[model samples]
Target: MSSNTFKQAAEAARSKTSAMNKQSSEAVSAVKNDFLHTPVMRAALPFINGGISGMVATIVIQPIDMIKVRLQLAGEGGTTGPRPSPLSVTKDIIAQGKALDLYTGLSAGLLRQAVYTTARLGFFDTFLKGLSARAKAKGRDVTFVERASAGLAAGGIAAFIGNPADLALIRMQSDGLKPVAERKNYKSVIDALSSIVKSEGVTALWSGATPTVARAMALNVGQLAFFSEAKAQLKAHTQWSPLSQTLTASAIAGFFASFLSLPFDFVKTRLQKQHRGPDGKLPYRSMTDCFIKVAKQEGLTRFYRGFGTYYMRIAPHAMVTLIVVDYLGWLTQ
Candidate 1:
């Protein structure tokens, strides 16, 4: 009697445990299904994927970006200043501090990508779908002009929204150029942002918004529009695999992006890096002013001073970001 009772109790316990496990699994599955099927969640996936992809790419490319910024800012006031190569900039950064100095504004860079890429890529995808649908309704394919317009619009909107983070990134990266005593020594992106808002105004957070937006528009047109175009062309004309097509498309996009945006990017860095002097006057008044002054004084080529480094930074970043985004989209699909 005792043995049977004990066995019965053990069996009941096992049965209850199994039931609980089954219930938990069902519950998890239900939740996953809801997440996948919910309109809001589905709508938000592109932005989430874009941010994650951009952050991953930024982590890999931050050092190169740092060097690129340094190169752009090297001969600031005049064309006769030292011409620093990427190698020289890398060495100098290491000499000044450590290898990690090459990632001086990483927090700001990540923040910038999180906001900027999320919005731009999400908007681009959304716009592309709408355009494709319309074109399909008319029994036609999406045109390059339509793609470029979508990219430009997405970039402009995203840049405006992400200006604060972009400003903080430029400030942090350029801080090391200041005297040790003058450096704010921002501990993080938040610190840099708060400091800027405290010393300057909220408006100052968008110090280079004009150039930033312009650069973003140029970049998006080159990167997004050209990538789509290249991929379409490759698919239609070549016998390349999907991976080959993507890689080649991304490379083409990166070059166009770097070339088209460098001038605006150069202006953006300078404008964002500037602060009011003792007289409360900033160096450059606006995007146009900066462009003019730089062209007049520093020579027009100053805008393209770091083309090679910029290309290296932009190309790899574009490749990694697009690849990761594509993979993520595939997974989600």
Candidate 2:
């Protein structure tokens, strides 16, 4: 009786384990097949890829962005003198505290990228895909003009949606450049948002919306258009590897992006930080006034204040983002 009972129990357990394993394997295979084959899965891939790549790029580049903002804000002291170079700004920042101080507004930067970059890149890809499909149906291919238009529209919309985060970012970055007593001392992205809302009201969050949106449109047009065309050109005319192609395209994209958007970016930062004087008058009435005054008073070069640092930040981020996006898409598909 004991031998028969023990043998039967062992046999039952083995059968149950084998059946469970088979079911699990089938489920895994089904999931893998659907992810590889489904249209819906493919469609959502761009958004996921773009969002993740953007956040990753933002993390890598936030310090340079913070330094760029500080360089621009450090100009307040330079009005009667020559503007400080990026190296001087970096040294000054390091002198103020630890090297990591250069990443003071990192949280805001991440939030901005999560909202702005994600939306802009995702929407551009989505729009591009739609246009490509339609064009293909007509026995045509998507044009560069079409790509630029998609990028511009996507960027403008995303910038508007991300304005609050962008304003918070500028404030947080510039706040550290202020006198200790005058600093708002934002604790984090949420703290900055809440403080701005409490002190200034909802509309204040969008104070520089015009310039912000303009900068984004310019940036998208430069980055997206240049990258696409440059990559295609490299592919068609040369035998560059994928890595070489991405790096070259990204550098070209970054150059144009920094050049076209720096002016608007400068204005946007100033406008976002502008406040009503004790006399109830704001420094600049609008974007045009800000641009004019900056050019006249600070000189035209103020618009390109930190071009080297900006290029460093923009180029690496663009390359990382594009490469990651491509890699993720291939892995997923």
lDDT of 1 by residue, 1-333 (tens): 699999999999999999999999999988887887699877888899999999999999999899988888887888785778889989989999999998999999999999999999999999999999999999999999999999999999999999999999988998998899999999999999999989888988989999999999999999999999999999999999988999999999999999999999999999999888999999999999999999999898889988998999899999999999999998776
Give the candidate number with the greatest TM-score.
1
Candidate 1: give the clashing pairs: none
Worst 10 residues of 1 by lDDT: 74-83
Candidate 2: minimum summed lDDT over ten consecutive residues — where? 73-82
| Clash pairs (backbone) in predicted model 2 | none
| lDDT score, candidate 2 | 0.87
Off by over 4 Å in 1: 1-34
Candidate 1: Cα lDDT at 122? 96
Compared with the true structure, what per-residue lDDT tens digits does model 2 show for residues 157-181? 9999999999999998888766799
* Error in Å for residue 186 of model 2: 0.9
Reference-based TM-score of each model: 0.91, 0.89
User: What's every prediction's RMSD, in angstroms?
Assistant: 3.4, 3.6
In order, candidate lDDTs are 0.94, 0.87
Residue 226, model 1: Cα distance from true site in angstroms = 0.4
